[model samples]
Target: MEGTIVRRVIPSDNSCLFNAVGYIMEHDKHKAPELRQVIAATVASDPKKYSEAFLGKPNEEYCAWILNPEKWGGAIELSILAEYYGREIAAYDIQTTRCDLYGQGKNYQERVMLIYDGLHYDALAMSPSDGAPEEFDQTIFAVRNDRTLGPVEGLTLNLVKEQQRKRSYTDTANFTLRCGVCQIGVIGQKEAVQHAEATGHVNFQEYK
Candidate 1:
């Protein structure tokens, strides 16, 4: 099987929106016929001149428009660091894979054929080899809305207060999936809170 792989990148800063758009334009210039048509149509229908038109007022709207395959062109499989103004946030990866199989064998004999009547073969024998190259294509997209005017700080103090408050009640454990296959189990709830508060750091305890 064969397929095209595409990726798009958007910066976390609004000042870079035009740059991101430019990147997409350049990519579209060399895309395959099918994808090129899609890109051209989307741009022509909704020019990126006005911020509100392409970059909606709400971060979600912009994300939905860009990632929706049906709405926008299917050229871009992933976008990264896409943000509007950093409140609502989303980060994800898109990937596609394709594979092909082939069979090879020769017919036995003219009049007399070797049937190997002494033994029988399983149906799996006719199948292709288990080893095959897996096509892997992936794209990553992250978006966040900027709400605060200035950089936020004071993480250590905030963590300490949170640990104290939680300690006042009781220790509770929490489990979170770090990624696709990793599970992080937080043990000693109070200790974990205290550690986070004191060091402003959290570590994932991994398990299968």
Candidate 2:
């Protein structure tokens, strides 16, 4: 079933959230920056409304950073797009064990999957009745919650595999490397090596 159901891999860049949204919406990745900017503007325009306590940075600063191509996107971006597009987005976080349905304000009658492994977002949708991938409104993607004979079952496994595949193309330096000697974790090869050298440790392992 996982093999039959289709998933789209956005680029490994920091703009993954935007790219994922664009893929699900059947838009070109080149147009993702514009979509990202739109969400940022919406947040900047109304900070108090969207700036929940979970938002790490202030609305203004977050908005500015999100516009940068190197900045990563997460719940903030997901929520903004859900509202801006007037559609429901179901996000499942494998690491955090969180599942949320956003943009319930409107009855968009459609939903899509945003798989979060705590660091990246990937788009997932049904393979369609005709077994073809086409540009269709994400709002029309049918998702069954009954978990019987639908794509929802085994979705977590599919998403986990997709995340692993995406990571294979990414630089290992972006991953968290743990020092085997001290059992301490650090991000990036530089940090890992530096920590090892500073502590006279050599062995290290990468944690995904």
Candidate 3:
């Protein structure tokens, strides 16, 4: 437990990846959008490199979607950031205990942590009070690859789940309401449901 690293909980919005990257780099989640923009531009500039085969969408559309604040970030974004920052980003998949290293440098002087539950991502860093941060790549890969590495309190799993649940609810509320049967717009959930009932149109959509 003496050498255990403390994990910081980034906001559980869809932008969790960007927020995690921002936190690792600047200790500020507010920088997430800027980081997201940088990654978006990087992907945009090389569509063929991050093409549909790898990104699951056509390069141009994926580029646009990746920059959306409501969009989530994933391995593709993480790898780009590692390369852009010239620092290793180690991702630990908690369920599988899989540790993946990103970035090209060899010295491993600086590194940060990204924790992935099967569903969400969060940032981890050495607690300042715990002493100097190590070459995390070496610490995890070389020293403790066989063991689960984290603080005694664990990886903030409950916090991660709660944050994600709250974020999901908030995101759901942002959808625009429209009646499927009447094809008319409604102001909010109340009106949408009320309209559906009045028109006997059981189907409704939350569309932009």
> Which candidate achieves the best lDDT against the true structure?
2
Indicate which candidate wins on TM-score.
Answer: 2
Cand. 1 TM to true fold: 0.17
Better of 1 and 2 by TM-score: 2
TM-score of each: 0.17, 0.64, 0.59
Tens digit per residue, CA lDDT, model 2, 1-208: 3234445566756677888887666555555788878988888788777575546778877778778776667666777788777667777665444567777556665666676655457776655443565453232355444422254546545655665566532244577767777799888757864775588665666677
RMSD (Cα, Å) for all candidates, in order, is: 24.5, 7.6, 10.1
Per-residue C-alpha lDDT of model 1 across residues 178-198, encoded as one tens digit per residue: 221223334454554454445
lDDT of each: 0.25, 0.64, 0.63
Q: What 10-residue stretch in candidate 3 is worst by lDDT?
A: 137-146
Backbone clash total for model 2 is 1
Query: How good is model 3 by TM-score?
Result: 0.59
| Candidate 2's TM-score | 0.64
* Regions of model 2 farther than 4 Å from truth: 1-3, 51-54, 96-98, 128-139, 143-175, 178-208
Clashing pairs in 1: 79-141, 85-146, 86-145, 86-146, 86-147, 87-145
The count of residue-pair clashes in candidate 1 stands at 6
